[model samples]
Target: MAKSPMDTLQLSYIQIAIAFLLFAQAKSTTEHTSTPQPNDTNTACIASERSALLAFRAGLSDPANLLSSWKGDDCCGWKGVYCSNRTGHVVKLDLQGSGYTIDSDSRKVLAGNISSSLLGLQHLRYLDLSFNEFDKMQIPEFIGSLHKLRYLDLSMSMFIGRIPPQLGNLSNLQYLDLRSSYQDRDIHDGTYSTDIMWLSRLTSLEHLDMTYVDLSAIVHWLPVVNMLPTLKFLFLTSCQLRTSPESLQLSNLTSLETLFLVGNQFHQRSTPNWFWDLTSLKYLDISYNGFYGPFPDEIGNMTSMVELHLSANSLVGMMPSNMKNLCNLEVLYSYTSNINGSITELLHR
Candidate 1:
């Protein structure tokens, strides 16, 4: 049909309107397709958390240049830092000091207050600040707030004062080591913990080492440790823990496998009756104490015992006759003690 001018104009306007709509729709579709995925956007370290880590580094004196990798914006890739794959949240920070003897130059050690900014890293699960020198500062109480922490090691660090009971707040903690080396004990002024009631809350704790920390005042140590059903390795060397364990307390430590009680104040050659009560012990060390009397017959019950050390004490009499049952025994140290009878048969066995 031959159209009028008005009809032609109307038809042209309709076509133009459709073309414009199509162009707009194509542009929108292109833009939508190019949009970044949520996971890609989350690949970068969270800005606030990165800042928090940088702030934490700022307070440290890094003479060794150990934290040089901490310059960039992406903290997940920083040295000694670990981030979650799903959320990119900082999960672990290990700033262990360079392996240096105490007598050597100590400049590599980190010293200063731990910045509160670390609290922003709410997902931190493992923190190890061992072998550093914090100038005898008390362990910060705020660290207890890191609820997700599973492993924490401050061993050989120069922290002094009562171990903050606040650490009990880490309910998920599985391994904790605050042990000081022989050098640390000599150079540092003092460190001790009088109360450990908070330990009762860490139901998941497995390995615990508090060697060289004075624990003489904690009368409930046995009872408190007994509550941890999952405990396996325990190191309490030179703790001066004088209290004896009660039968009730000994009954609960059924899972303990390795025990180190080296250099304590349990003054006698006679083995404490409770020593035999640890039926699951595979390793035992009670060296440099005042133990006396004959070798314990009750010790034969521990068929799983692998190492036995009873040196530098007053242990007397012949070795127990029933010790042949400890077929798993690998190492035995009975040097520097008083009179001891020979047992060639036990040795051959």
Candidate 2:
């Protein structure tokens, strides 16, 4: 049994077979571990969109290098750029100057032209260029083409000339801020709107701030504003407006919470009676308007009023007895006015 050559040969064959099988298994394991897998890095931005952003960057004078991260191929990873996860579409471009200092000689404001190349971002939903300096350039009519935009803030951005009616094309716009400086209202170099009939088309508008934009030319502005049923915050401060709330036959602003009409030239003899219908209004600032007459007893109807500012008006007489109905009143300012009211009684109520 110890000297059997056939048995030894068979044993050697078995060992060789097992060795080959082990080597094959090791090779398979090595191949499985070393194989390249799909890249899991965040989706890269589309090449065309990235090129559009680069073109947009080329137009702006970014003195603060605020756009330094914009160099890479993936614009989705760039500063102030946001992309949709599913489609990798650039959905937001927020280059607001508030993130930088504007008071110093080394102002961080981005100056220069806003390129129309931004139109390439067809899926962009939010765009903010507030607090930047544009050298009194007129807002580009091309911005209206960005129909997907839901938020647009261009406040204090030094944009001049007539507001383009093309903005009405933004049917999906929910928040719009075009607040400029009152000093910016020059006959030749101010942001003025001769025809704001386009505003009525923004039926989805919820918050609108057009402070200091000269709207004095639009005589029938009230009715157009009344068409917006979803408006929550309406700030038209110092707009040189002449339209009185009384002109509105029926107000549809049931959702209005904050209404700022300060520094306007409404010149009404009395507070408009239509104001009482804003029962849902939480903050109302109608100060500095040339309103001269007795304070309306309708103040009692504003039960939801939280802050009421009637400063610098010509309203006279004691507070209305019904003012006690404003149980939620938090702040009341009637300074520089002839409104003599017992504050203790009004507050205790």
lDDT, candidate 2, at 205: 85
| lDDT by residue for model 1 (277-342), tens | 888998777766677777777788999998777766677776777888988987776765554566
Model 2, position 52: C-alpha lDDT score: 95
What RMSD, rounded to one decimal, does every model reach?
Answer: 26.4, 26.1
Error of 1 at 118 (Å): 0.9
Q: After superposition, which runs of candidate 1 have C-alpha atoms over 4 Å from their true positions?
A: 1-43, 99-107, 181-188
lDDT of 2 at 200: 91
Best by TM-score: 2
Clashing pairs in 2: none
lDDT at residue 26 of model 2 (Cα atoms): 33
Candidate 2: Cα lDDT at 147:
97
Write the residue-wise lDDT of candidate 2 on 1-349 in tens digits: 1326776466446433543343334334432432222222486789999999999999999888889899877788787888877778888887888433555766667889999999999988888898888876998999999999878888788889888999999998888888774455574666889999899989998778887899988888888888899987788888988867673567789998878787899888766656667899987878778888988788899999987877667889988999989999987767656777577888675
TM-score of 1: 0.83
The clash count for each model shown is 6, 0
CA lDDT of every candidate: 0.74, 0.79
